[model samples]
Target chain A: MNILRFITAGSVDDGKSTLIGRLLYDSKSILADQLEQLEKSSAKKNDNGEIDLALLTDGLRAEREQGITIDVAYRYFSTPARKFIIADAPGHVQYTRNMITGASNAELIIILIDARQGVVEQTRRHSIIASLLKIPHVVVAINKMDLVDFSQDVFNNIIIDYSKVATQLGLNDVKFFPISALQGDNIVDRSEHMAWYDGPSLLQFLEEVPVENDTNLKDQRFQVQYVIRPQTDDLHDYRGYAGKVQSGIFKKGDRITVLPAGISTTVTAIEIGGKEVKEAFAPQSVVFQLKDDVDISRGDAFVNAAEAPELKSELDVILCWLDDKPLQTGNKYYLQHNARTIRTIVRTLEHKIDVNTLQPLEITSPVTLNEIVKAKLKTAAPVVYDSYDLLPANGSAILVDETSNSTVAAVLFR
Target chain B: MSAYQLNYLEELEAESIFIMREVAAQFEKPALLFSGGKDSITLVHLARKAFAPAKIPFPLVHIDTGHNFPEALEFRDQMAKEVGATLIVRSVEDTIRVRKLTEPKGKFASRNWLQTYTLLDTIEEFSFDACIGGARRDEEKARAKERIFSVRDEFGQWNPKLQRPELWNIFNGRIHKGENVRVFPISNWTELDVWNYIREEKVGLPSIYFSHERELIEHDGQLIAASDFIRLDPEDVVIKEKVRYRTVGDMTCTAAVRSGANSIDEVINEIKATRISERGETRIDDKVTEAAMEDRKKNGYF
Candidate 1:
């Protein structure tokens, strides 16, 4: 079965967690013991004699006490068609970092917009994040339709408003779903009340959505993670570069070039689980044996010589400041790209993009927490990278606070 | 034409292998924590595939609780030898003796929590910067919030609230001198994913995982294997049942479920039909409190 990794983002009380819990509960993913525990907890909290499904994803003690999700909580559930990994991201403005973290690896994002209040600021904020993270699919789940008496007008208005935000953010594959998470409408099964609405249920869309072609199959990029050499007598001469193919396809006897070193060699062999294969593609972890013994180690990239990625010491990037401390110009950080980590200095803070307004503000002050900004960075050594629009896996990097070693920023190269 | 897409299992394997390789490349001294369970066995397999032809760069560290299943201990040793890995065994009994710590008593007593001390001591002894384990987020509620590369304080405590934001596929494994990282390569995998991978990879596991006729004792509605270490209360009755272990831990606390899954295929089918979770059915340590796993993890338990 395939795995469809997605995330849910919405403000507090917007039913993001409730939607996730409903999906899990309706799909029979919640175990008997877990459901029992949820019931007992609901009774203790006296949730109006109704089981509060939101309590399922609120795993932390503080989150339970505060009745708010504080961090990203990954929930796993599977149907016969596919396994789903849901990153239930906290929706508060203070937890924007959490949402970005959740959406980083997500292929789809469910931006919950309360039907009573269509397309609020938080909804736009989440849409910008989904676009910034390059999430391939976007589903605007207009939740709490029951509160509005399951009105089709409310749902249509939400779709109309969210469509503008989606277009502005350049989110191409945006789908709108109208549902009430509390009443389980248009989630697992089609809602009879909404006969006017013609579309697949949320679960049906999630199951049938094509996630296979999401990867970039036009550019072959592989980062050598480890150099394998067994000095044992039987395999004394064996040498291979182990890594997952980031994009495109690599076949046996294909000519590839090692980045930074710029040396070309033929792919003598491709081995998956120690068995030689004719070819390998994106996301497949394999070892590549080169015909010529070119000097390559961890942090080296294997690319098609015909289409090498841009190599430079200076890069213009859009980064989300994740650290508590504000980003200062001329401060050095440890920039980690793929398997490579190098000292990088913040050259300039160009402008900060106000996610709420979708406008870039001139940098009059330091970039603070959860602020998205376009900046220039100079690394001590040249690094290989692609535009994030071209290939997200190879185009992104992280900024590590040199002193505390915390991941301070998420870098997306332009 | 068939679309070139990796199935869920293959994607999980590739992600795990990437994490293992990251640990090797980022850390100074790394070790794989082997528990002889299906998860750890799968971790070992992924580690081997991550760096084929070459032996695993690091050693395998096993925190011996001295209450392990005999079959599990034997399998651990044999697998270590087969992989040509240096196996380092640290005994919880030694930690208990040296620290003058009293073991828990009565029907719910288990050495699972005490294993934390031995594990921390082993890391300090070897100066291992990264300790990779097979912890999956779907195991328990507390584990759901863990990052792929979790940082621990010098004292080996996990502060869930203060965890670093892990973004994209890039994991920040940098830490101060005394601090270490606990890496979970399979953090995204579920129990079913592990079983499917085990079947696909043909990974060897201990005999206890498969169904067998074993002497069992019923305690607090849980079917536990009757072992020499567990003291039976008068109310508990010992009987023979065909059972299989869902999770392998200290035999004193790990519960067994009645099953006829004698083969991997049967086990997969059995798990597919299982309503109770892997930890909910077994793992007596997590049954103590709602935050039992969190409390133990805060004190450096794997």
Candidate 2:
């Protein structure tokens, strides 16, 4: 089954958690005892004897008491056709890091908007981040249409406002749906309230959407995870290289290059779970036995000799600052990329991006938390990597503060 | 290898292999947590594939609660021999006998929670930097929030609020010397996914997973397997039923469901029609509250 990962972003009271709760509840994903406990918990919070479905997804105790989402709460549910992983992120401005983390790998991002409030800064910020993260799809769910008397004009107006924001962020494929998450309209089933809107329901869109080709298959990237030397009488001197194919495909007899060493070899066999296979493709964890007895270890990558990426010591990157402490110039930290890591220093701050306006500001100092900026980093050693836009699996990196050992920023090569 | 796109199970296998390799490369010393269950067995299989021809690059750690099924113990030994990986077991029974821990009372009581102490002691003794387990996020609520590389403090406790921001495909495993990481490559897998992957990969499992005649007693609306450890109350009634375990845990807490799924295909079909979740039918501790798993996780229970 195809897996569709999505991130949900909206204001605190925009009914994001309630919508997720309803999805889980209506789909029969919640177990018997879980629903029973939810009923009991709802009864205590019921001012007018109505079950607040939000309780099912809003897990944090403080978030439940405050009736707001505080962090990214990941929820998984599946229909027969497809599986869904929802990253329900917080809406507070301070939790922008959480939203970035949630939407980083999302194939689709559902940006919730209050029907009454046509478009707000939070909505634009989410759209900006969705674009910055290169999330392929965007669904603008104009929620609370019932509160606006199910007026067609209200929904149309919100769509127009969202389009303008989407345009500013260079989002090409943005979808709009008017939904009343509380009333279960235009969610799982078609809504009788809006007969004029002829788009497929949210569930239908999710089921039929093309999510299979989201990964990059053009670049053949394989990071050597471990070196296997089977010391047995039958297979004595058997040395195999094992790891997952990050992208593209590899077949027996294909010419492959070992990175850092620039040694050439031919694939002899592919073994997945002890069985020999003819070939391997992206996302398959299969061990490859090469023809040549090359010296290889962990933290090395194998690639097509013709299309090997650059091995460089310096990188220009767009970084999303996630730590409380600012990224000071000339500070050394660990830069982890794929299976490799090395000490990296902030060479210079190029420009700080205003997420809302997409404007770059020149800063002589370091960038702080919740800010996106472009900076130059110099590593102690050369690292093999691709542009994040080309191969997301190999392109991305994280900056860890050496002193605190905390991940302070996510980096994308520019 | 085939013309068709890689299926979901294949994808999960690839991802898990990637994580296993990361653990070996990033950590100084790492161990695999083996529970003799389908999930852990799946992890062991993936680890083998991740470093084929090279003995798995790490040892297996089993925190024995002393309430295990005999079949599980036998299977664990056989699997270790077959894979050629060293198996290390730390018993809670020894911990209790030596006064390192106290045993709970009554038939309903369990040493499951106390196993955390034994596991911590084993980690401290071995100085393992990373311990990979077969925990799935879709299995419970608290697990849903766990990162692929979850860092535990020197005390072995998980702090959800202070968790590292795991972004993109990048996993940050850097931690202090005392702080260790709990890695779950299959954290995103569901129960159905596990079964499907097992079938697709043609992975071998213990015979207890298949339907067979077993003596069970009804207790707290659960079909607990009748064993020497279980004390029969006057109100309890035993019956012989053809049953299979959906999940393999301690014999006392893991329940058996009436099934005729003698094969993997039959098990898959049965699971599709079943209305209850896997934990709902198999786990006893999860029945107590909605936050049961979350609370246990916060207390350093894996």
Q: List chain B TM-scores, each candidate.
A: 0.98, 0.97
Clash totals, every prediction:
0, 1
Candidate 2 lDDT by residue in tens digits, A285-360: 7788889888898778889978888789888889999999988889898998866778999898888998777888
Model 1 vs. true fold: TM: 0.98
Residue B156 local lDDT, model 2: 90
Among all candidates shown, the one with the greatest DockQ: 1
lDDT (Cα, 0-100) at A122 in candidate 2 = 89
Model 1: lDDT to the true structure: 0.90
User: What is the C-alpha local distance difference test score of each model?
Assistant: 0.90, 0.85
- Which digits, one per residue and each the tens of the lDDT, describe model 2 over residues B1-302? 23546656666676777789888878899999998999999999888877766678899999988889888888998999899999999998887887655677788677878888888889999999999999998787678778899999998998888888988767788889899999999987888889998998788888889999999998877899888777888888889999999999988789998999999999999987787888888888787766777777777878
What's model 2's lDDT at B115?
84
Candidate 2 deviant stretches above 4 angstroms: A362-366, B1-4
What part of the reference interface contacts, as a 0 to 1 fraction, does candidate 1 reproduce?
0.77
Going through the candidates in order, their DockQ values are: 0.78, 0.55
Q: A1-414 in candidate 1: lDDT tens per residue?
A: 799999999988899888999999999989998988899889888758899999898878888888888889999999999999999899999999999999999999999988888888899899889888889999889888889988998888877787888778899999989898999999999998888889999999999999888888889999988888888899888998988899999999998888888888899999987888999998988999999977788889999988989999999999999989999789899999988888999998888999897698998888999999999999999999999988998999999999989899999999
Task: Give me the candidate number with maximum TM-score.
Answer: 1
